[model samples]
Target: MQTSLAKSVTFNGVGLHSGAPVRMRLHPADADHGIVFRRIDVIGMQNRVHATWDRVTPSKLCTLIENEDGVTVSTIEHITAALAGCGVHNALIEIDGPEVPIMDGSSAPFVAGIRRSGIRFLRAPLRAIRILKPVEFKDGVATARLEPADGFEIDFAIDFTDAAIGQQSKRLEMANGAFVRELMECRTFCRQADVDHMQAHGLALGGTYENAIVFDGDKVLSPGGLRRPDEAVRHKMLDALGDLSLAGAPILGRYVGNRAGHAMTNRLLRALFAQPDAFEYVTLDADQERLLPGAGVCRPVALAG
Candidate 1:
């Protein structure tokens, strides 16, 4: 069955890149409404942006989508991840700004809000993209690939020179509330030098020690360092899930990323669709539905101890 929120949920915060204050609300939609983002602040142009791979614009920093009229929204990964992780099929995200708020740099706040708003099942069948062949995209050292799998899975690896986050890798079956328990609270991280560079360039202006994990040489500059020893990689996996959600349906495939970021994942999606033989859309069966990321997950749980 497809699902939608039972009521509206609202969020307020600053955009990680723009540093602008924004108000966003998630409202329930009818079945097949999919996920559409409306720019409430836009005056007259087409304000509705569909959350789909084809709508993604190239950005090295975060996932961004634009409507035909050139209205765009950035940093939407967290909330989209929350929706996909919760098995929501349709929603209308209304935002009075150009970016979704950073919100502690994690999806936990979104997940918690979604759980509190509750999920209402729509009387319609759910569909998923089933990988039929391996599809991969690569740029320099970064790579993103998708291959056949019985259930959704994510395997990610990251290597950085900073001693605080040198090398990390993790793989998990993202089903049965695994995203909520394992990945939702992992915060976005960046090296101190990168933060300085981005801020100098008028980007990541809203990023603070409170919202994003900051690494300086061998030290974690964020307070209460290291939620998990492999948080950097886990967050990468969380990000991959968000980018994949842009596919517009649940995916029954294993995604593997190596130093991959938003752009590479979007490229992989383009590659997958370019060759129709790579994937097929199918109405999910009971067994297949149970294997999806949000299967049987009713409420958010406390972070693992």
Candidate 2:
């Protein structure tokens, strides 16, 4: 069955890149609405931005979506991940600014909020993109691929020059609320040099040690250090799930990402959808539904962890 939130939930915080304060509300929508973002502050322009891969623009820093009228919203991956992770398919996300909040640089707050609001199941049967064959996209050292699988799985590998975060890899079957329990709290991280470079260019204005994990040479700059030793890679997996959610449906496949980012993942989606033989849409049966990412997700219990 499809699902929507039981009630509206609101969040307030600053954007990691723009540093602008924004308030966003997630309202339950009718079945099959998927996910749409409304720019409440815009006037005289189309304010609706569909959270789809086709709407994705080329961005190095974040996942951005723009409507035909040029209304855009940035840094949407975290909240998007939370929605998909919680199995909320029909939502109208309203934001009063150009970017979603970077609350704690993780999807924990969003997950918590959704859990509090609860999810209501609809009568409509759920549909998912089932991978038919291997589809892959690559750029230099980065690559992302999807292949036929019984359920959604994620495998990620990240290598960084920083000694504190050299090389890490992890693979997880995203069933059974694994996303919320194991991955949602992992925050975005960067090296001190990258932070300095972005700051010199007047970017990441709202970024501070409090919001993101920062590392310098061999020292950890963020207070209390990392929540997980391999947080960098786990966050990468979190990002992969969010970007893949742009498919606009729950995907049943094994996703493998190697040093892949937003742009690369979007390209992978483009490649997958462009090839008709690569995938197919199927209505899930009751047993198949149990294996989907949203199935068996103990929202309240997962959030507690």
Clash pairs for candidate 1: none
What local lDDT score does residue 103 receive in model 2, on the 0 to 100 scale?
94
At residue 41, give the lDDT of candidate 1.
Answer: 93
Q: Which stretches of candidate 2 lie over 4 Å from their true place?
A: 298-305
Off by over 4 Å in 1: 299-305
lDDT string for model 2 (22-84, tens) is: 999999888888899999999998999999999999889999999999899999999989988
lDDT of each: 0.91, 0.90
lDDT of 1: 0.91
Measured by lDDT, the strongest candidate is 1
Model 2 / residue 27 / CA error / Å: 0.2
Using all chains and alpha carbons, the TM-scores for the candidates as numbered come to 0.97, 0.97
Q: Model 2: which residue pairs collide? A: none
